[model samples]
Structure formats: C-alpha cells, structure tokens
Target: MLRESHKDRIQEEIGNDEIVTGKGLNQEISLVRAEDTRWNSHLKTITSLISLFPEVKKVLEYVEDDGDNGASRLQASGLLSYFKTFEFVFYMHLMLTILGLTNSLSQALQRKDQDILEAVDLIRTTKAQLQMLRENGFDQVLEKCYSFCDKHEIVKLDMTEALNPCNSFSQFNKSSLLKLSKMYPRDFDDKERMILEHELDIYYHFVYNDVRFANLNGIADLARSMVATRKHLSYPLVYRLLKLTLVLPVATATVERCFSAMKLVKTNLRNRIGDDFLNAALICDIEKEAHAKVKTEDVIDRFQKMKTRRGQI
Candidate 1:
C-alpha cells in the first residue's frame, strides 16, 4: 500500500536512473517482498534493503506519521520498530558478510572449469577464513554493527554483556569437538606418518597399478578417461567413485531444466501423446546439438525399418 501510494513520486525522483555502488546494483530497484518458496531470494531482498536503507527508512517514517488510517499507521510503526533495531541491523550485516563469502564459493562450484581438487581447496580456504573470522574478527564485525546502528539511529546494546546462546538448554561439548579434530592430524608425526602410509599403500595398490588411470588429472578427467577407454570394468571401486563425481547432479538445476524442456515439448496441444513419443520428443528438444547432428534421411530410414508402411515418402 505504501509503495502503491507513492509510486508516482518514486518514479519522479528515480526516473529510471540507476545508482551504481560496490555491488553494481541500481538504487532504482524497489524493495522486494520475500517469499518462502524462493529462499535464496531473501539474499537479494536483504541486499536491496541495504542498498536502499535510507530511502526505505524515510518511506517507513512517512507511512507511520502520515498514513490515512489507524491500522496503516500502526503497521508502519510496528515495521519501523522492527526494522530500526540493533538486532535487525546486526543480523542484516552479518548475513550480508557471510553470504558474500559463500556466494563466491557457490559460483566457484558452479563453474565448469573448477575441478574436485580446486573445489576442495576452495572449500578448505573458505572454512579456514570463516574460522578465523569467528575467532578474531568478531570485534571488527561488532564495531561495524555499532557504526550501522548509529547511522540508523538505533540504540546500541551493551557489548560487555554475555552473549546469548542459540539454545540455552543444549549442551555443546567442546572437548568432544577437540577430540574429533585430533582424528585428522594436522602434522605428520610418527603415528600420523604410519596412518598416512597405510592409507596411501591401500589406495595405490588398487588405483596406481591401473595403467588406464595413469594420466588422470582430476575426478572429471578420471570419469571421462575411464569411459573413453572402457576400463570401468577393470577397476570397479575407482570407476564407481569417478562416475559419481561426474554424473551426480549436485544442484537440481539439470533436473529442473529437463522438466522445463518437457513442458515446452509436451504441452497441452500434445498432452495426449504416448509416453514413448513424449520421451523421444523431449530428448530431441533437450539435446538440440545431438538432434541437429542427425540427418532427416537417417530418421526416415530408421522409421521405415521399424515396420512395413503402406507408402514411403
């Protein structure tokens, strides 16, 4: 309602003009109403809010002070109280900071150029950075939060007070975590050296002796090499592992794409098509390059060979 009422004014002020910042986001972008179905959308929503925080605060204040109805005014006041708080401001910055790190990692994982080793290294680096942040950067984050709160005119909380645990009743066993961390030895001591030797011997005995995998670069390379050489039968365990790394779709993106392609291929107009026909049509539509490679004459010959026909074109 607030947006609708002031749409004309907002348009007049912004006028399709974009305000570029660090993220290259435009100030003309309106505040997004988040939905549960699209959880990642909340990240974008938060970003937009942060970018337009000043303008948004002004609008919220206007609604609270000048709303036409009591209900609108009350709602606006509640929104202002909720938004302009130390907790909200802190959490907003916290999420933004964390998500910025994870977004890079996510993009790295999504890249075709990233192999398992690189991805694993990226994960370890990100994990270490997060641990470092938790251990040493809390004060810096706190200072930033304080700065944001001051800018927003929200009262700062007492920093000396003990921080509240997420679950007061839950017991966190720090000793157990320490013990678990020790399971993966950081230094190659006598015991660690023996463990590493045994593991390496077992691994090399199976995979290193295999000539076909001699030049395998990464998991992706292993999958392709094994399949190309038809050596999957020679090394069952290694083949299985490599196959999983290659064929297993991590993000449901491929499945979603297939479904979307199915919708286009098997629409209401072709709803009554047989299951086999639908599958074939979907395959052709989805695999456009492969379908393009196939000649029309070859398809005609294959159709004719399937069964006897009254006439052939």
Candidate 2:
C-alpha cells in the first residue's frame, strides 16, 4: 500500500510540512526487501522497517479501514495486529542488535584483498563480542525493549526469570587436543604426540600469562611472537601446531576456489574434455597469479621440445 500517494499521506499525517509538486516527497523513506543470497540485506531491511514503523502503521490502518479491495483490507488488518505484538517487537530489536554486531566482520570477509590474517583476527573479535553479549547483554537489550514497548503502547510480557547462558567456547581439553593431533599422524608420531600433550598444557598457561602474547589477535601473530621470543624452540610441537592452524584457512579457500573454477571450465560445450586436460585447465584457471608470471616464449619452447617437429617457428 506504500505507493507515492500513500507515502504523501503518511508524511502529511506525521506533520512533515515539506511541500513539493509532481510526485516529489523529499522525506519519504521506503522499506527494503531482503534477499536470500545476501545476509546484510536482512540487516538493511530490519533497519528500514524500524525507521519507517510509524509510517507503515498509518498506511496499514488506512488500508484496513477504507481500502477499495477486500483482500487488501484483510491483509492489512492481520499485519497490523501482528506488528503490534510484544513478540514481534522484541525479536525485531534482538535481531537488529545481533546483526549490527557482526556486520563489520561480514563486510571484512567479503573484501577482495585476501588478507587472511585480518580475516582471522576479525573472526576472533566477533566470537568474543558474541560471547560477551550472551553473558551480559540480555538486561541491557530488555531495557531497550521495555522503552520501545512503552513508547508504542504495546503490552510488555513479564520477564521475571533469567536464563543462565551456556558457555560455548571451545576449551583445549585432553581428548580434543588428541583428536586434533591424530588428524596429522605423519607430523607427530607416538612419542611426539605425548610431548605435544605436555607442550599444550604448558603453552596455554604460558601464553595466557605472558605480556607479549596477551594481546595477540590471530594465530599468525602468536606464531610470530613465539619466534621472536625464541619460544618456538622451547615448544617445538606446539609451534608446529600453530603453523598448521595458520595455513588451514588458505588451504580450505584454495580447494573451494578450485571447485568453483570447475563449473566454468567443464561447461556443456567442453563436457567431452578428458580428465587429464580438465585437471590441467582447472589448475591454470585457479592459480592465475602463478600462471601469469611464466613467459609465453618459455611455454612455447617447452611445448616444441616435447616432440620433433617438421618445421620450426
């Protein structure tokens, strides 16, 4: 129901005295529709909804009371009732707060710079923020919800009981550490695995207490700190584990990119290509940076040297 005329009516109802001719509503705010593929779209939609709430209610009330179409009137009535409920308002504010917290991290990950270290640091920061919110943010959010309900004349539910937030952060326990070590059997034999267990116990305590490593943001930073302090020699197995963790994201992204490149390489027109040629094409396509560095003349000379030719160029 939020057409140009409807927006004009909303503006007039809200006492916005701006005058403009020929469909020029200078202060009109429109609702945003969310998309499935883009998560930030949901955040934008929520923000717009919150901003245009009074305008939306005015439009819906007009439609429900005096609209020309019966179906439109029924829809507007149902929506108006739903929008005034405590549950809807409460969840809307909750989602707004949560999405706002992670929006920066989401934008960082989508950047084209491929700075894995920064991305990892953002991941850690996001996790810590979420944990803190879970532990201590409920009362603050509830107070906001209460103020909103009071302003809007919505009924407030009694929130007398409080829930104990469960701790979800992963702890480096013995079993978990052993499971991680077993993933790379070649890197750690039986003797080294036992040593790694001991090293982990010491490493966790040391890092937590050490001033230099206290503020390290990412695994890469921790690795560098270990080397700079010559602690890598002190805990060789733990240092090795840090190195593995550092490359895990890069390795995962490379594998994902290779699979994505396959879709472009093995099209319907090229479906008949052999496995050997397909593999070579995918490798070149995925590693374009490395492929671009080689000289064309060198590739041509290498191809020519593979077999005797009747004519040489």
Candidate 3:
C-alpha cells in the first residue's frame, strides 16, 4: 500500500512542471521487491521505505481513513500504528546496518574471481563487526529511534518501560539460565574459542601458508597458477581439495535467477519440453553473451547438414 502510494506520488512528480527537468530530483526510482530468500533485496526494500517515509506515512493515513473496505482500513491502521513506533524504527536501522555487511559479503562471494582465502578474511571481519554491534549498538540504535520519533511527532516510548517484558512468562528468571546451561552441555563455555583456534590453525598452516596458494589472488588465478606451475602434481591432495572448492558452486543470486527463469520457461503450457531441451534453453537464457556470439547462418547450415530436408533456394 505504501509503495502504491509512492508510485502515485512519483508519477505526479514526474508529470509536474518544475522537478521533471531535474536529473537527481526526478521520480524515476521505484521500490525494489524483497524476496524472502534474498537478504540484499530485503535491505534494498527497507532502504527505499526509509527514503520514502513521509510519502509512505501520508499514504497510510489516507488508507486508514479513506479505504474502500473495512478490512483495508483496519490493515492500514495496524500498519500505520506499527510503522510509527520506536521499535520498528530501531529494528529497521538495525537490519539495514547488519544487511549492509552481509550484502557486501554475498556480492563478494558470488564474484567469478572470488577467492576462498579472501572470503574467509571477509567473514572474520564481518563477524568482528557483528560482535562489536552486539556489545554496543543497542543504545545507539535506541537514541537514533528516539530522535526519529521526536522528528515525526510519534509517541516516544520510555526506554525502561519498553525494556520490561510484557508478561512474566516471557521473562527468563536467573534460575532458568542456570538450569538451561546445566541441561545443555553444548552451551557450556569456550567451545567457540576451541573451534576458532582449530580453524585458524588449518587456515594459517594449510590454506594460506602454501607457496602455490599464496602466489595467486583469486580462486581462478589459483587454478591457472597451479596448472602452470604443475603444483597440482606435486601436492595432489591439496590441489584436489582446492579444485573441489573452486568447482563447488555457492547457491547465491545466480541460482535464484536460474530458478526464476525456470518458472517462466517450464510453465504448464511448455511442459512438453524435455529436460535436455530445457537445460539447453536455460543455458542460452542465462549465458546470453555466449549465445549471442553464435551466427544464425551457421546454425541453419548445421541444421541443413544434419539430414536431407525440404528444398531451399
């Protein structure tokens, strides 16, 4: 509903006299769709919502009062109530903060030249930042939320009151913590430390220290360098492991795109297409650059040569 309202406003602005000629001030932007499996898309959607808050609020107000149906009015009222709160603002900022790092990491991991070594370093950096945020970001977020609420004239929640659990059952007693820890040995202490130490040992001595792996910057480079240097033959097991890692596809945006395309291509009307044909079609769809390089004349010639067919001038 908020996006729909913004769309109307954007269209109005685009049709307006003054702002239409401006480059940056124009209303060409649209809200991104947030897919549940794609965190970056969600981040983008949230970011867009934050940018269009005033317009969104106006739209919500209109819907709350002027909706055609009771259900819509109720839904809009609920959404407006939820949106105009310190908790929602704080959570929005918090998710945007966290997803920024994760989005970068996701993009980096999906790069064609992505290195496992570099990915490990990026993961460690992100983990450290998360730890810092966990320790100190709550108060900072609350302060920002307070300022936002003040600016928007929303009822500001008392921090102390907000911190209290709504129900006694929802609050964990001091004794419950002790009991939970006693019940679960896995939650006891220093397990994470031990795991980190062991992982660091493997990475430092095995993955990073090797001269072959150290020479190249990316996984693709590593593969090529290993082949050129004949290090694969020298360290067969390590090379095989590295090769496996390089070949192993990370189910990131590429896989999501493939599935999205598959849904369109394999609709009920086109269900008769064989798996092999579907695979070929998908390859052509996904690798459009490669597909575009093939000459149509060459394809026709090949088809003609495949069997004796109807006469062609």
Candidate 4:
C-alpha cells in the first residue's frame, strides 16, 4: 500500500522526470539493508562455507556428483552430505546471518518435507557451532525480524511450496518446460522452467488473492493522492507499492548510516558543501573500515575552499 502510494506520489512529482535508478543507489548499502536477503544470504552461504569450514576442500569433493538428472547442482538427498558439511553454518546463518532464510524455512514446515527438516537441523547445528565458539551465541544474535514483511505487507507463495503444488503432490513427475518459453527465454536444458512456473504461479496467486493489491487498483487512487492529498510527489503507483511493502526501518539502515557520516563531514565548517561534495562525504564514511579508503579531510578541505566557502572554518 505504501509503495503503491509512493509510486503515485513519485509519478506526480516527476511528471517529466527520469533520474538514474535501478539498484544504483548505494548498491552495497541496499544489499546491507535489503527488504529480503534470501538471494544475498544464499550467496553469503559460499562465504560461510569458506569461513567456517577448514575442511571446505574435503567437503567440496563430496558435493561433486552429477545430479540424478545430470543437472550437477545437487541430487535429491545427495545434497544431504554437503548439507552436513556446512550444517554448522545454518543456525549461525539463521540467528546471526540470514533471517530471511529462517522465515522462509519456518513457513516451509507445513509441507513436512524431509528437506525442510534437514534445513532446520542445519540451522540448529550452525547455532551449536556458535555456542561452542562463544559462551552464549544468542547474545551476539539479534532475533531475525521480519518487521518489514510482518506488518501491512502480505507474503506470497514461498519457494518449495510454490514449486510443489497440491495437485502435483501425489506424483513425482511434474510439469513441462516449453509452456512458457517467452518468460524463461534462456538456452538451458531443462525442466527448471517447469519448476519455476509452478513457483511463480503460486507467487502471483498470493499477490492477487492475498495482498488485495491496492497499487494497480486504479487511477482513482492516484488522482486522489497526487491531486487531492498532494502528499508524496510524482512517484508512480507501482513503485510506491514495492517500496512500502519492502522498506522497513531496517531496510534503510545503510542510508541512515550514510546520513550520520554525512552529518559529521558536512558540519558547520563544511556546510558550504555542494551536492557532489556531500556525496563524497558519504562514500568516505562507509569505506572507513577498508584499505584504500578515502580521507575525510580531502572532502572537508574541498568544501572549506569552495567558492561558497564563506563560513568560518
């Protein structure tokens, strides 16, 4: 609702505007403050594997079998062995690493699949790994908050449930790949599309059936907001929907952090800063922990010496 609302407001505000967009806004910060970390956390698993397991090289050999269908990812139950090697990472990943995984897995419990059980066990073991590493792992842990999704936002079909429908539950064999070639127009051998189709269908069902989609609801809502309320500016209705559902207090933590750093750099002494100068301040602030980091004075000095540099340094 909020995102849809935002979209309307934005569109109204930018009647003829087209600014830079699509994941370019502090891309790293966006990942850090994501509304959903499932995809990123999955990538993080590789890091966890590299970090926690000293025996990662040994484990890689076991995870190296061509799957039943020759797909080469992981065979059914074949993933079990690899699952164990990094089993210790689960709880740590869950409690300490990926909260989105926890939520997704918990919801998967309804299916009663052995894989889900394994996943839960995996998370538990990861927690145990942390426990042994520390006296109380939970202390370092912040219970994963689905604060963004938990409120007004409605959840769509999750991964597994989405793929495995009730109709196809009885049969081991599933649907075909060629059905929606346009959507999955990629050169890939496979029924992967068939699997995806099931999941996507369920996701759409949840969106239309569950969320009561107010964004695409109509022009009346947009007219009311832009012309009547005149609240948020020309943001389109669709963008508004995405932002509202996704943006929780946690989602913009990176942005907030950047703002804090910006405030420190662009203080009264640096208040003569240009937009570009302020942007540089944010960049330097974030890279403080890394090598090749930018210096604060470099920016501060530039601003202090600006043509508008009338302020007392």
Candidate 5:
C-alpha cells in the first residue's frame, strides 16, 4: 500500500513540528496517532477530521439550492458538521475575528489558494456575526459575536426594553419587518445592514410560534428580542447549554423513535399492560443499548430455554 508504516515516518508527518501555527488555539497541540488520548485537541485531529469529507466545503459553495429570494442563501450543511466538529475552535476564531486579530486574519490571508482563502473567509464571516443586548440606556455587549442582515436592507430600531421573547418574535409580524427595513441608515456598513435584516427575518418565527413559547422558553425569548431590534442573536452560554439538552429531541429524532418503540412493545402480546407497567416496560425495552457493552446473551438465552421447557410441560 502507498503508506508510511513505520512509527517514525508516521510520527514525522504528524509530528508536533508540522502543527505550524496556533493562532486561536488555546490548548497545546500534540501529535497522536495510534492510541494517544491527547489527539482530541490536536491540529491534526482538527484538520484531518475536517478533511475526511471535502463535501463540507461543497455545501457552503452551493449558492442556490432552492429558488427562493436571491438575497437569502443557505448556510453550509458542512458548516453544521463543522460546528459539531469544532465548536471551541469556532468560538475561539469568533472571538479572535470579532476582536479583529491581526494574526488570525493574516493566517487566513496567507493561504495562497483562493479557494481555501474564500472558504476561510466564509467561516470567518459566520463566526464574526455579532448581536448586542441593549435594554433602555444600558448596553450589555453580547460576546457571542455574529452578524445580522445582509447589505441593501440596512435599518435602525428605536427600542425601549431589552426585548424578551414575548415582546420580540412572538409579537412580530410581517408589517413590522417592513417597518424595520425602512429604518436603515443610508451609509451603514455591511454588518450593520445584515444584522438589521436578520432581526426582521427572525421575527417571522416568533410570530408563528407565539402560542407554544408564550412564556416558557427562556432562550427563545432572548432570541425574540433580537428580532425586535432587527438583528439575529446568539447567546453563547445559554444557547449552547439549551442546544445540547434540546438536541436529543430536536436534532436526534429520538422523540419519534420512542413513540415507535412504544407501539412495537405494546402490540398484542403485551397490550393489556397497565399504564404504569407499559411506561416502565417501554423504557427498559428501548434502553437495551446502554447494556450493549454488558454481555447478557447467556442469561437471556437461558431464560428463553426455561420458558420453552415449562411450556412443553
């Protein structure tokens, strides 16, 4: 095979020396090949994993999947996977990029390959989008840096309180969006324009889901406020925490799976099980995956054999 087999050759290619730059990296990058646990945060780990599928960049490259408004483009499908792969890296770059780090920009600019540079710029654009939380006179400069709307639709908003979800999205309507778009200052920068536009678009979701999120969802409320000001918002701590927790249902499709499992187990043989027993049995039956490492084939097989013998009698 065309490969480096020796420990030395492989280590040489993946060595610490090749890590080159650690611009936004916090942890020390290490080389891990066979069984080293330290590879989790290494440069090789980051790049190799991102490199596994060139398809990621392709998703970002797609400008028009749906024939919708030309102004709105889809975020890269690879970008989400990139998110799963490198949240810390994304945030680190976000911080560096928003702060306008000379080094970070330089690394991106230094890439002679136009394609890579453009991709890096696209990634930077996403990471640098910023939303501010201003309630009345106070400005709580939000740290989750990101942009809002695109150019051409710049707008200004005159708001009172820091808009919460109830006051923001759920309450927003299409007419309000048009009004926000009208408020754009003539000489606004690209980012300002985008933020204002993003806020308006965000308002639509709130208008649709007001009933479901009337007062319960905390993060949703905060996002709704961003809609009020006509800027897309990102709450780093709260959003990440909620995302990880909510992902099981929203992202994983596990809720539908549980219902399916319930139907499967409650079929004719065990249809008479009471509500209490039915719920418990469903839980235990679906959670067999947790004991996957724990072998119990022999116990189950014996139980089945004994049940068959008794039935024979």
Candidate 6:
C-alpha cells in the first residue's frame, strides 16, 4: 500500500515537471532494493537513490506529513533526517566510487565466456586503481561529497579537519607459497616443494628487473612471455604455480555456471528430472561451446556403434 502510494506520488511529480527526466532518469525509475547475495545490486540501489534524490525527498516529505499511520509518518521523518546527514552522503559517494571501480571486474568474472586471462587483467587493473585511489582519491571524494551536500542542503564537514591515511599491501611469502602448494599435493613433489621458495625468490627478482615482464597484460601474457624468453624452464616451479593460479578462477566460474544451469535445466515443469539426467543436462548446458561442436552425425554414429540392433532403421 505504501509503495503503491509512493509510486503514484512519483508519477504525479513527474507529470508536474517536479522530477526532471533524462540523464539515465525516467518515469520508469524507482527505488531499487539491495540484495545481500549480489554486490552489484548495492551499486544499482545506490545509483537509483542518487539519481532520484530530490523525488525521494519529496515523496518522503509527503508521506511524513500525510501518512495514514503514525508509525509510517515517523519512519518517513526518520529517513528524511538520516538522509540529510553528512556521513550518509559521504559514505554514499565513497561506496559509489569503490563499487564502480570493482563492478566491471565482478561482471567479468561471472560472464559465460569466462576468459581467465581477461579476468586476471581486470583484477590487476582494479587493484592498481584502488591503490591509486587510496593514495590520491580522498580529496576528490571529499570535494564530490561536499558538492553533493551543498546541492542537497545537507550539513557539510569542515575542510580544515585533518584525516589520517591508511596504507597496506600484501606480498607472497615462502610460508604462504608452501601452504598453497600443500593444497595441490599431487601437483608438487617433495623436491619441487622444497625448492619452490627459492624459485619464487629468483622469479620475483628476475621479473621485477626485466622490462619485458613489466606491464604484461595478464597472467596469460606473463606465461606466454616467460615461455617466449625460455624463462619458464629457468623457473619451472613458479611457472607451475602461475598455471595453478590461472586454473582456480576458471574452476570457480564453472561451479557457479553449473548452479546457474540447474535453474534452466530443472524448472518447475521439469521438477521430476532425476539426479542422473539432471547432471548430464547440466553438463551439456554449462559446456554449450563444447556441446555445440559435436556433430549430430557423429552422435548418431557413436550411438549406433554402442549396440548391435536386431533391426536396422
């Protein structure tokens, strides 16, 4: 009832030219609810909130003054008050910036194509952008926040206030490498495990000093570069580890894709699908690229070869 009222009010506002359309805002725009399962949903919610700020305030004000129940009026009043706070505005801009940076990478990871090299490249780019933002983006964010607060008539923070900076970075250590190696025990022998740390040290220094390895697009490029320069032979353990790292993302995406495929394969109409058939269907659905390559004639030939029929059709 409340949402319908709000929707009607928004339409009225639009008709009165109180809420301007264009620049991604339209009559169809509404408050998007964030889902806990998906990070991108929060992005959508924030974007909608920002775009519909004025209309939202108007709706809230109307509800606060003319709500049917005291509780609804009180809730609307509280939200209006909270919306005007400097902290809320500041965090909204901050999250918008952070999530905007990572949104592409998140989407890329979940793609059906699932390019491992491209995903790795995006991860690197996101990390680099985040590090750069950490070092230099505070003043920019602060300026935007101040601008937004001023535009919305919200109370702004003092520019004279000094803020402490936080900084941290992670490096792969021998212990961490050993732990990772233990997870793939079959991939590493006792000798390889013992010498892995040494290979890593040499590989790190070599790559750091070598211009050829610097600014490589992704792990795939790095692997190819190492092979091109015959450095993979020099650092076999590190190359193995790199190969292992590349496979992990694809494996995770495959599992996610399988679960997604299950919804399409075993719908309400096909709810009686057995486990065996469902599994086979999921495999075919998830690996559509591979499945598409198999010719119908080849399948027919293989099926015919599987059994000797009493009567040939």
lDDT of each: 0.59, 0.71, 0.63, 0.39, 0.40, 0.73
lDDT of 3 by residue, 136-177 (tens): 565666576777778678765543221122232123132322
All candidates: TM-score = 0.40, 0.45, 0.45, 0.20, 0.20, 0.45
Kindly list the per-residue Cα lDDT of model 6 for residues 1-313, writing each as its tens digit.
4355557766787899898877766445678898644567879999988877877888889999999999999999999998987767866987888888878987887689988888889899988888777766766787888899888898665322211011111233455556556646789988889898777767766776777765655556777888999998998887787676444221123544676687788889999999999988987888789999999999888888888987653
How far off is residue 175 in model 1, in Å? 33
Clashing residue pairs in candidate 2 (N, C-alpha, C atoms within 3 angstroms): none
What TM-score should be assigned to candidate 2? Answer: 0.45
lDDT of 3: 0.63
lDDT of 2 by residue, 209-247 (tens): 677765655455667888999999998987776665443
Candidate 5 per-residue lDDT over residues 1-313, each given as its tens digit: 1121233333554576753435563232332352221212233444443233233333334533542555534444435443433233333333333333223443454467757757667556534432221111112111221121111122322121213344433443434333333333343345554554665455446544656445534444555544564444442322222232222111122444576678787888877889898877777767778645545776577777775565521
- Name the 10 consecutive residues with the lowest summed lDDT in model 4: 154-163
* Candidate 4 C-alpha lDDT tens digits along 1-313: 3234344444554565543445543121111222232334544554444232323333344445433345444453454453442222323333333333334443444355558567778658655544443443322232221221232132311212212323322211222212222222353225544454564445344434422333433323333433443422432322232222222212222544675577688788878889987786677677767625647777688878776755755
Once superposed on the true structure, which residue ranges of model 4 sit more than 4 Å away at CA? 1-256, 267-276, 291-313
> How far out, in Å, is residue 171 in model 1?
29
Q: List candidate 6 stretches off by more than 4 Å.
A: 1-28, 159-313
**lDDT agreement of model 1 with the native:** 0.59
In what order do the candidates fall by lDDT, top score first? Answer: 6, 2, 3, 1, 5, 4
Question: Looking at model 2, which ten-residue stretch has the lowest summed lDDT?
Answer: 160-169
Of candidates 2 and 1, the better by TM-score? 2
Better of 4 and 5 by lDDT: 5
Clashing pairs in model 6, backbone N/Cα/C closer than 3 A: none
